[model samples]
Target: MTPSEYGFLKQFLKSRSGLVLSDEKQYLVESRLVPVTRRTGHKNLSALIADLGPRGSEDLKNTVVEAMTTNESFFFRDKTPFDHFRNTMLPNLLEGRRSQKRIRIWCAAASTGQEPYSLGMCLQEDRHKTAGFRFEILGTDISTEVLEKARTGVYSQFEVQRGLPIQMLLKYFTQQGELWQVSPELRAMVQWRKLNLLENFSHLGTYDIIYCRNVLIYFDQDTKRDVLQRLAKQIPEDGYLVLGAAETVVGLSDAFEPVPQHRGLYRPRKQGAAASPRLGSAFPTLKAMNS
Candidate 1:
């Protein structure tokens, strides 16, 4: 790809989805988008790019980003955080929010929906305890393609093997040749949508917990700060915000404090509260890891 061509693609991506394609990623552009090129009936990426130029082609633009975004996830991704959520966070929130009888969660950057479904799987175990309470798990991502797959709740054997426990796999997923389909009930408890985190954060309603995990590392610092600020407004006063083990809100934004109970877990805090978002910084990270 010509430097001008590469620069155009980079700016296009950054503007549309906040994903920065480093110069080293020129090969990535060639490798990943060649299929898109073929599917669009273009013989080459240069031809595709020429046809794409300012043509009011929102669909084509969407296709490019979808082709580029990563979709990596699994059941009970990291054991400890879910364990903390089940043993403490959920229980504590259940008691604290008894008056509301509602527990809301958002898995931001929920590529292909495994994280929210994981939460739903756990919630199913305690469904009876919160019978009257409304529990909702919403999953959102920028890639329409991944969101569609997530909605279907099916996974390949390789996808299932990534951190999925054998017992839960047997319990929640039905096998069909090489694919594993998550149980209908578990799939039903979560909602999925295509969301771009770099833009305005409204439209996603407030939540008791927002799991943004590993998605933000790809963004620039200003984007990160702006996103964190926008996210602060969506989480309730006592709500928690979970990020990857390598991520934190410190020096990024002044909206949340780290919850010491679970490492790398965060909760809403007053503005200017120092290092509020406590991170044990352990692993299996906030869902599918960036590493």
Candidate 2:
């Protein structure tokens, strides 16, 4: 692809998906869009780029945006976030929402449903403690393709082996030919939707916990701050926001404050005052159970 075409693609992706492609990522763009060219009969990346503006095919524009959005995910990815979920987040919500008897969670960047499903598995294991509570999980992604795969709840042998415990695999999934499918019950726990974080998402309503992990790394500082502030609106002051280990709110926005010792966990800051103190983060991770 020519430099001009690459530049147009970079801007197109930024406006459409809040993705920021640096100069060094020209090769990355070329590599990721090659399949789009073959599938759509565009002949080359430049041809695809030419067809992407207001006069271009809307379907092609969406396809290109989806192609550029990264959807890498696995069960209990990064380990520590799930550890915070099971050990810290869940317990707090269970107590805080006892009167309401219902708790909502949003996996803001859910890709192929691993993160939401992992939370479902955690809820299942704690059934004895949460006997009478109702849990609602919403998993949204920009890629309809990944959402479709998530709805099907199927994973290949290699996919399941990554960070997925053998015991949980045996308990929650059934071997279907070469792939494993999560139980219908577990799949039903998460509702999937196609969403672009850059657009308005207030209609989806509030949640007790929101996991917007790994996705912010792709956004420039301005876009990151915009997304983070919007995300803060969907969470109540007492609610939680979980970001990737590499992402943080300290430098960008003060809408949230880090939970003590929990690396990737943050709770919404109270308006006009500091965030409330929480219990210590000395809670043990689920390593033994997962192992």
Candidate 3:
């Protein structure tokens, strides 16, 4: 692609979805957009770009944005966070919200449903503790294609193999030919919807926990700070925020501080405390878990 063409496509993606693409990602753009070109009957990326003008079809623009959004996910990704949730976070939240008897969780960028489903399973395991609590899991993503798949709660054998414990799989999934379907009980626990991190989230109510995960890596620092600030507003004082093991809120936003002894866990910065300095440096031990 020529310089002008590359710049146009990069800026367009950034404006639409907050996806920051650098010059080195030119090959990635070509590879990802080739199918868009073919489907739209454009000869190449240039033609596709040329057609995406002020008069462009909304559907066409959405298609391009969706095509570029990464949707990689699997069951119980990065065992540590789930471990913390099951052992620490959930129990704490359960006790704190005992009076209210309600628990709400938002899993941002919940591609293919695994992350939220995993949380559902965790809740199931601890059902005895949450006997009377009402649990709600909302999984949101920018890609409608993945949201549809997530709602179906069906996965191929290969998808099940990744990060999914065999025991949990047997307990929660029913084999259907080559694919494994999440049990009705578990599937019913999660609600999936289309959400853009760049857009207003005031319509979505506050949550006791929010999992924004690996999605922030695609944005520039400004976008990251803005997104984190917005997310902070949706979390209550004692609520938790989980980012990808490789992502952080340290330099980006002071709205959150790393949870002590938790790899990828964070909470809203305390009201009267100083912001944690260089908190991202403390996450070296956490590995990237975006599979």
Q: Point to the candidate with the largest lDDT.
A: 2
In candidate 3, position 58 carries an lDDT of: 85
Question: Which of candidates 2 and 3 is the stronger one according to TM-score?
Answer: 2
Q: Pick the candidate with the highest TM-score.
A: 2
lDDT of 3: 0.87
Q: What is candidate 1's lDDT per residue for 1-291, written digit by digit as tens?
A: 789988998988888888877899999888999999889988888887776678748898899888888776776666666765666567767877899999999999899888888888777766776678889899999998888899999899998888776777888889999999999988888988778998776877799888888888888888889899999999887777888777889999868777765776777776554434323222233333222
Where does the lowest 10-residue lDDT sum fall in candidate 1? 282-291
Tens-place lDDT per residue, model 2, 159-236, is 999889999999999999999999999998999999999999999999999999999999999999998999999998
TM-score of each: 0.89, 0.96, 0.92
Residue-level lDDT tens digits of model 3 in 12-102: 9999999999899999989999988998899888888987889999899999999999988888887887876766677678778989999
* Candidate 3 residue-wise lDDT at 290: 27
Runs of candidate 2 with Cα error greater than 4 angstroms are 280-284
TM-score of 1: 0.89
Q: Report the candidate with higher lDDT, 1 versus 3.
A: 3
